[model samples]
Target: MEILPADLQLYLETHCDIEPEALKKINRDTYLKILKPHMLSGHYQGRLLSMLSKMMAPSRILEVGTFTGYATICLAEGLTETGFIDTIEINAELEELLNQHFKSTNVEKKIRLHIGPAAQIIAGFDGPPLDLVFIDADKKNNLLYFALVLEKVRPGGLIIIDNVLWKGKVYGDAQDTDTKLIRELNDSIAANPQVEKLILPVRDGLLLIRKK
Candidate 1:
């Protein structure tokens, strides 16, 4: 899904936020121990997420996919003094590793990891308005996820959707199920009048939607 050339991507990471020692350990362990380590937003993207979080300094953050807690910790770096980022991971098996890494970063107290389908938790949530949201779970549910969180996000809040490009298939003629789902979501976002959006051609793609 990496559109950038290898050398350029490497250079960007080198110049970006020095992946902290704790985050470095999480990155290394994710590659060595987790399946499909590519899904664990690595150095460059993690730094971008961190930078965005720092800029927002949001008090309520929601992350749909908490793969190995890599991005989770990154987002936690820029929370309000009393802020918390609630994340959902469907796979219960990774709970142990997720908790271990979260603890290692000492951000466990700032993170609330929910184990189960994201739709349930998001739809039932009655917490304060969210200022930031990161959606990186199942591609098929991207549209549903967006809809569920839109009402909860305060006006002017940001909802960042990862992998909106679906490895460039969304723009291609590939009519595969996943690509079609992504395309539908992208088109819907483009047509929606309640928000303004942009697709940053980063790793895969990130569609940033800011509510009006």
Candidate 2:
């Protein structure tokens, strides 16, 4: 249920910046070997994530979903030399596949994959406040995850949420439960005074929030 026209999508891809050589390979391989290849953030969004990460130079990052590890790797690009990224993926079935690709990349040391419910796993970590948090897991628990991580993210840190647009169904006549939930989450972020938010039209929709 893509909201963008085919021509526009193609144009966006063509005109936007491309990913690095390693990311290019990972992106291609994920599509060919992964079950839900579309979940992999492609060139445009990947580049955006990488650029944001680089700009922030975060010491610690929290990724709520690691669907094939594409976005995880992208976010890791901006970490400090000794920094780390704690990424969670509920699907244990993709563990071997994700590990295989992760091992093949240089950022493997920086990414720690946790296989289980994100909320529960994140609750157990007693590490330093996260410099960046990317939420792309279950839509129904978006707000829950946000609340759980709110304290974990330091002031001025970034929290990025994906699929906020829900294929533009948020503004349409009617939407399924997931779409409605996403719309609600967007509104919740918009109304929250503790953070500054910006919703970008990048692939699907990405909400960038800076904790205050």
Candidate 3:
């Protein structure tokens, strides 16, 4: 769900750095082939994710969702030479598409695709200190993922949570399960003392939390 007005979104995209040719192709293919094309990070949010990743210059990154591998590739933009990203996707069906997308990319060597339940993958993860994490998976498990990720993220590391606004349902009196869970997670994160957090109204809404 686009939180920004269409014209405003277009203006923002126009002003931001141009989307890379590889990313543009992925965006086009995603819309043509994916079931929920909106889930793709698209142009603006993809640039934001890339910018954040570039800013962090993390040695190790964990992404909880790998929808179409758009954001996966974006986040890889700023990884150190030895840095690598471990992105998990529950749908094994997407593995082929993701692999195909990563095959010719420069970040291919820096990406490790995991096809399984994010919880299980994260629980067993024993990688180096995580410098950053991106959570864009099941809304109900947002807190669970946050807690799990917080344990592995080093001090001062960052965790990015997507869809926190849930297309404006979070502010309305929508009693739906996803909305309630997202609202609860939002409240919980805001109250948590372990990290400093801020929500950016980009795309659906991205919550950036830095471990303290």
**Model 3 over residues 9-40: C-alpha lDDT tens digits?**
89999999999988899988988898878888
Query: How much does candidate 1 score in TM-score?
Result: 0.97
List the candidates' TM-scores in order: 0.97, 0.94, 0.97
Superposing all C-alpha atoms, what RMSD in Å does each candidate have to the true structure?
1.2, 1.6, 1.0
Question: Which regions in candidate 1 have their CA more than 4 angstroms from the true location?
Answer: 1-3
Clashing pairs in 3: none
**Candidate 3 runs further than 4 Å off:** 1-3
Candidate 3 at residue 140, lDDT? 78
lDDT for predicted candidate 1 compared with the true structure? 0.92
Against the true structure, candidate 2 reaches a TM-score of 0.94
- lDDT against the true structure, per candidate, is 0.92, 0.89, 0.92
Ranking by TM-score: 3, 1, 2
The most accurate candidate by TM-score is 3
List model 2 lDDT by residue over 7-99, tens digit each: 887787788776677778888888787776777787778888989999999999999989888899999989999999999999999899889
Candidate numbers sorted by lDDT from highest down? 3, 1, 2
- Ten residues in a row with the worst lDDT in model 3? 1-10
